[model samples]
Target: MSGGRFRPLAGVLAATAVALTGTRVSAIALPWYVLGTTGSAAWTGVVAFAEMVPYVLVKALTGPLVDRVGPRRISLAADVVSAVAAGAVVLLDALGALPLGALIALVVVIGAGRGPGDLAKEIMIPEAAGRAGMPLERATGLMGVTERLAQTVGPAAGGAVVGLFGALPSLGLSAVFFALGSMVVGLALPRGMGHSAPAPADKLGSGSGSGSAPEFGSGSGSESESGERVTPAPRRGAGSEEGYWRRFGEGMAFLRGEPLLLTVIAMVCVTNLLDAAFGQVLGPVWAKESGHGPVLLGLCGSVMGLTAVGGSLVAAAVAHRLPRRPVLFAAFLIAGPPRFLFLAFDLPVVAIVAVFAVGGFCGGFLNPILGAVSFERVPRHLLGRVGGLQTSLSHVGVPLGGLLAGAAVTVAGLAPVLLACGAAYVLALGLTGLRPEWREMDRLRARPATARPTADGPVSDGSSGAEGRVGVRE
Candidate 1:
């Protein structure tokens, strides 16, 4: 890894470690909290919906804010908020004042904070990864690994904390982690590092030699005619003080214009929605009802996390060698059905582990490949907006998934609900309609070695890009 990017890289993982600790603790608590409180499955669903709806909406809406503020600032602020929110939960629980309504509201607050926190953290990585000169695929693959590492370690840790101590301690533990993460990123980043734009002098010279300001819209630094140098923009990819809606439109238009990148996001949305139902809400209920306790649930989480790590390693090692479309399509194809079957059959420990492992493996493969596509397709000028939009779209299914599962569980039972979810995954993954548009994704992973990204940067791919041209994250 390039030394320049290492600090940022560490910042991201540290933030993740903090964030996931909170999520795992919360995840460990969700089903039990609801069941303990109301004793009604329907009410459990409502809480899930309440928590996820805000998370989804906040994530979708915050794209421009992230773009405007810079991911580093956003990331740092989010960590602090997450820490504070988690800390509040511990205090509330301790005072014998915790109620389901208060708990749900607090969760909503945490979820909202998590949305931007996650976006900022993910957006910051590409800049650092780019500086490292790591191949986009390798960088994204490692990102997938980082997520899996958190998933693998976090739940087990949360389980141990909750079991050995209680939810209050677990929440407090999460707070400490997030607080530390905030400190590291807020203080440790080299000032203005990974925020390069072309010097204005280079832009003027390059444009005068060829095109105009419209063509050189981004990378807007200027050298003074009188020999004084102007300061560069504080954040990379920010445009002139354009109207937020207009800027939002432009981001949307960018994604609409990119067919393959758009497809990847759509695929992610579908899978995310279904998985949200299967993995997020229903799965926990199933585990709890299956005569297995929180410890078993924790074991299940650990297995999935470990397998996801393996999958990330596999993708990192071999992804660049494969064609992008097929790799991506195959990953989605493998991810969905295993969970349904695993639960449908009520498999033994080894079997259950195998099912989750496969799901995690496929999920691990999905992120890097999808991330590579996202990072490569969008210009540096719109990274934050695109990243935010991608995240928003990817998470769109969550609330609905939780709601749908809530209703479905009452009618079809959890096993049948899972089976239905598996079908939904296959449908979404298959809808991309494999085409010539995304055929060369791997080949385009880096701007052709011969041609540098021009001062103006690359335009959307002529035909395909126009279709999915809105908010295509890079």
Candidate 2:
């Protein structure tokens, strides 16, 4: 925990925040730009769909590459590309040469870069935490806090910039943020920080009896921050050309074995789909139709972002103490339906923002729980590939959501679409609450980190009896 050890984390955290802020700014700017210029909800949706397709596709397929090339390199490169893409949009607009086709293409480039860039940063958190002598939960919480803060700052800033100057200026600022993010990564983080390989499987169990912290920069750890030892991971051979698919396959196989993880992944995927529809397309359409302008759009998001930041802070402080299953289910129940229903109604703008804020508050607890479980389950060495796949699955429905919602809004009115999606959100949450596998979330809270499993069940060594928590990538 020396100042020297803390430098990398500071850099990573700053880079993550800046990069996230840029993306969020662009998120608001791009959709608003399309809506303003074209005045067509469908085109806005098409642009959104175009961006997300590449985001999800490249993120899903490139996990092995991220693992092999290392997150630092990927993160730096991705940010640079993102900056260029944003600049392209702004430059085109300035030249009065912006077209739907050209805009979509540039946004696609932005998404492609963002996908790996985000995964790389997420992959670095545990590594940064371990090296800095911080607990994993606290580290992840800090990360959640950073994201929530960025969420608050990015949209509010994007909205203000768009409201004052225009969408073009906001896009231009996005490029500045991306470039700054790249600079932070390049200058601040040390080489080979996130690139170490895991100790062989046979070596993992040998350290079970010891209480020492895992060695920093080791790529994998035999111990978690909770003082429980990790289960002996079966090590794979070194990375090579032929090993890429095999590594990718390994990540898939790991996820398949963890049904609870898979369940969480599926649930988040559906919710992310719904959220994309609501945020990127539906929200903008509502703002336009209500004559609220881009300022209201930003204000509503800012309120939600602020409340979500509070929720995330609370979750970070006390997530380990909360009951995993019921708390998680309740958080989702509160978070999901309210915004849609509020938008569906003819309530005043104040009422609408309040509901969105409440939903954002409840939504904040989710990531801490999900992140804890993911880090505890997956060995660090495989985080890039495994995390990438998880991220990809979680976002798979995003493009479809935008596309379908756009078409639906074009065909049917916005009110009906809002009502239907709201009802669907309620139904999905209710169904998930009833699933038997959900009980596993609670069970995981009682298991130790070091507890390994055979094909049958967990290996019951006395060392794994310590407190447990769980996380997921979404």
Each prediction's whole-model lDDT (CA): 0.59, 0.71
Tell how far residue 160 is off in model 2, in angstroms: 0.8
* Residue 333's lDDT in candidate 2: 70
Please, what's the RMSD in Å of model 2?
A: 7.1
Q: What's model 1's overall lDDT?
A: 0.59
lDDT of 2: 0.71
lDDT of 2 by residue, 334-381 (tens): 777677777876789889878868877877777666655565456655
Q: How well does each candidate superpose onto the true structure, as a TM-score?
A: 0.81, 0.88
Candidate 2: stretches off by over 4 Å = 199-230, 233-237, 240-242, 451-474
Model 2 residue 286 distance off true place after TM-score fit, in angstroms = 0.6
Clashing pairs in 2: 229-450, 370-471, 370-472, 371-471, 371-472, 372-470, 372-471, 373-470, 373-471, 374-471
